[model samples]
Target: MTQTFIPAVFYRGGSSKGLFFHARHCPPDHAVLERMLLSALGSPDPYGRQLDGMGGGTSSLSKAVIIGPPTHPDADVDYTFAQVAVDRPVVDWGANCGNLSSAVGPFAVDEGLVCAADGEALVRIHQVNTKKIIHARFPVRNGKAVTTGNATVDGVAGTGAPIALDFLDPGGTVTSGLLPTGQVIETIEIDGRAFDMSLVDASNPVAFVAANDVGLAGSEHPDTIETDRAVMALLDRLRRAAAVRMGLGQTPDSVGLANPKIAVVSAPATFVTLDGRTVEGAAQDIAIRMLSMERAHRAVTLTGAMCLAVACRIEGSLPHRLCSGHADMQAIRVAHPSGIVEAGATVFQRGNGWHVESGRVYRTARRLMQGEVAIAPFEGEGDR
Candidate 1:
């Protein structure tokens, strides 16, 4: 009844960590793959702590990455990310994680799945969920991977080499256009109150609203935000309303799969980050606090940054109010609880519609460890 152990790499890509699996080791069938991954990560536990499995009992720790040679024509590698819940043994594969995408290129090169020359290699990764292309620029010296550099991320400590990520065609990844609601901004009546909302799908779909209306200053730390039961109640109501309006679904208690993320925005204010570094509020466009999977994220989500960038580039909206007046390119210095992270997007006026060629973001990742991971024994007969 012993399950075969497979070699994998445990990496901390940006603020998130996950186990990267070689594509060949994963099941090809969708249902079988889901079952195997659930067992492998040790999910569905009522206690919420993945003590008996590899999951680290949080969204940041509970993750998985699958990569290999391209199955489609225009891609170099197929990258898939899974978010495992802490309390439940479920993997939400409906969206893409740009933070974890940083680890994939190096993992592929180390596994000999792809070849890199003596210098930098361009990794074209096709996200399976959104089918969007994430272009990663990696440094390779002497046929080995380089994890050290001069690039520094807000949440992570120290400085390392830079990995420039270009998110192309961020619009319409899941839906049909950049503005999922067919408008740049709209007023939504939530709980008998009118709130200005921007529904955009740059890399993922998000509904941006003002923080003050939600009774938040938008500068509080994650712990402070998490403890407020009233804040969570308002967020839940907004999220449910936004989900239904965005064509996601009409389930009040269970819109888990269709995530209509709720984001609160405010004028920037100086604060000490969790890492003890001080960030100036004047240097940022707007302060943002995005809720992920119905919880306050330790740091701002990567795709959340993309949505912010896209918002800043537009002409009229909550984010557009903070734009620097430059019509060509806009850079948003988003302040998260951990620290400040920046994402940039170039805007061009093409007659009536705006064109966002790509979104640029910087993140740091390190290979923490590499070895074989042994899963619990499976006694049932093989489906295949």
Candidate 2:
């Protein structure tokens, strides 16, 4: 009954925390790795609670990131993200983890994959899953990474140092074009009605729709939203339909890729945040809430926030309708379920069309533990 252990780091980056491992340390075989991850996270329970594993049994906690040497010339590290299902004992490699991305640079710097000076330095990371490059800017003092600053992100409780993240050419991260459909907005017929939607494939591909059309105020709590099984069912249908239209899948049920998230937006309105703080509509450009792995995110994902920023900057888009005319090509503030998150974008018009040059945001990361996870040797054997 001897168990084998794998080296891992349990760290909190932004609003989420997960187990992270260097890519080289993981097995190249799929079945073996999947089994190993299940034992590490403890899953396949019908109760939806992962009481026996490292997983907290939530979408945010059941995540893993694998970082290794980059395959691209300009990139410094290769990041592979996985979302392990708490109840399935299976890892879904179909999407990127935006929260964990904030830690890739620090991990690379700590692991000696990339070198930095005694001040602020830029670490280029190639998101291997999407083949996109992200410039992660972190502060360094005396040759070590510094994690102290005044910048505050809403989802996280305490204010710390800032990590400036610039996602270059998010439009082509997954494919070519900000609007994969080559249009800012399109009308889709679903359930015998026409819904205005925007399908964009930036850092993440997302289908943006109006909240009012979906019978929502865009200010509901995560628990309240998830409990409405009817709403969840409708969203699932919409997501599946959007997935097929975006060419990400052949059918609604096959829309499993976590990137190109699906979201609904609405004009800013007063709502009590997760922390119980009142968010004033006048102080925000737009109010939005997004779904992650088919559930409302407690706050918002960094990549999703990037997509929202891009949507806002573009004219004739749902996000643009919520703007107060203050957002420009450089910066825009979005109001999420947690509070407010500010994202930056580089854009310009070319040949009668608008293009997203890049998108940027700030996130924080910290290593919680460094150790190995043990598992039964029989697990993951010959698994496909």
Candidate 3:
């Protein structure tokens, strides 16, 4: 039997990595693409380790991105991100990957999908899943995107050229407004205990709860958070309750931790980072521990950063309480498990409530391996 080959490029964007595919080369049918993606990533492995395919098992690595010529009049490219489940044969097209979104501009510039200038290129991307615009700006040395520089970000090691991503009108991408539940804070009863949380809609829908409320010191390592089964189960229940309040209408058992993520936030007080460096309370405005797919995120997602940026500005919110004296600052440095990430946001009160005009963050990306990824024939489907 002849194996099917698909042209794809693997890239490391921010802290996560994913396979980037050209829309022109991908199967036009959604069903076909769905199966192909699962095979390419070796999903439904049950062992949760994608040992036979391109995926690295974790949620951040089990991803695929589809890009093409601009679909919107104001954008230079159309980007659709896919989150492939490592343990199940499911491809959730429910939200965009903020880390992977940083790579789209460089991919577009290299693939000839869009032309770029010699110095810097501004790529206007139409994010398909969320119906949002991500303005990606990066330096271009020579005729291609620059991959080397001194710019550094948390989670990712070393430094590289910076990619500035501005999410315009980032609010309400997945919900009705900035406060998806129509309130800055809401208390839910879980197992006879009341937990107050804020559901904010930025680049994605996220439920913010204080670290103390979720049983954490806010400075614990990912290993500690991931290994504690009881803690994880508690977070799942909290996330599911949030999903209901936010109108996500999906249970954690069925949905498997995404779309509307849960983040445990803490106030800015001296704490040690994952790398053993003490982060002074004065250096950061707030501390965050974001959960991606039910596990602790090494660093905050670009979307999560955007969500936190907005949350910090909303009065009475968990993040806002911790981020005191930063209401007038243009940017908020979010201290996560990895390090500090500074995200900028423009927010103000509108007719009804507080609104986020945009959210911005800096990231870097590099094309790793580019070639044809051969995949086995799908079950019941003939070889391509």
lDDT at 193 for candidate 1?
85
Task: Indicate the worst ten consecutive residues by lDDT in candidate 1.
Answer: 322-331
State every prediction's TM-score relative to the real structure: 0.92, 0.94, 0.96
Each prediction's Cα lDDT score?
A: 0.78, 0.79, 0.87
Q: Estimate, for each residue in 183-262, the C-alpha lDDT of model 3 and write its tens digit.
A: 99999889999999999989999988888987898877777888989888888888888888888875545544576898
lDDT of 2 by residue, 1-384 (tens): 467788888878887888888878898998878877777777756687777678877888888888888899999888888888877756788667777888888888877788888888789999887888889999877665677778777888777667888888878555456777778887787779788888877688888888888888889988888998988777777777877777777777776746557788888788898888998887777777888777788888888888888888778887887776435435676888889888887766788777888888889887778888766556335542
Count of residue pairs whose backbone atoms collide, per candidate: 8, 3, 0
Candidate number achieving the greatest lDDT relative to the actual structure: 3
Local lDDT at 226 for model 3 = 88
Q: Write the per-residue lDDT of candidate 1 for residues 1-384, one digit (tens) a residue.
A: 567677788888887888898888887897777666666677766786778778776677778898877876777899988887766656788778878988887777767777899788888888897888988888988766688888888888788767778898788677666776777778878668888888777888788888888888888887788899999878878877777667666565656633667788777788778777788877776788888766788788888888788877778867777544334545678888888788888765677776678998988788887888766656576732
Model 3 global lDDT (CA atoms, 0 to 1): 0.87
Q: Clashes in model 1: which pairs?
A: 43-89, 44-89, 148-161, 149-160, 149-161, 150-160, 151-160, 170-202
Which candidate achieves the best TM-score against the true structure? Answer: 3
* Candidate 2 TM-score, true structure as reference: 0.94
Q: What is the lDDT of residue 322 in candidate 3?
A: 79
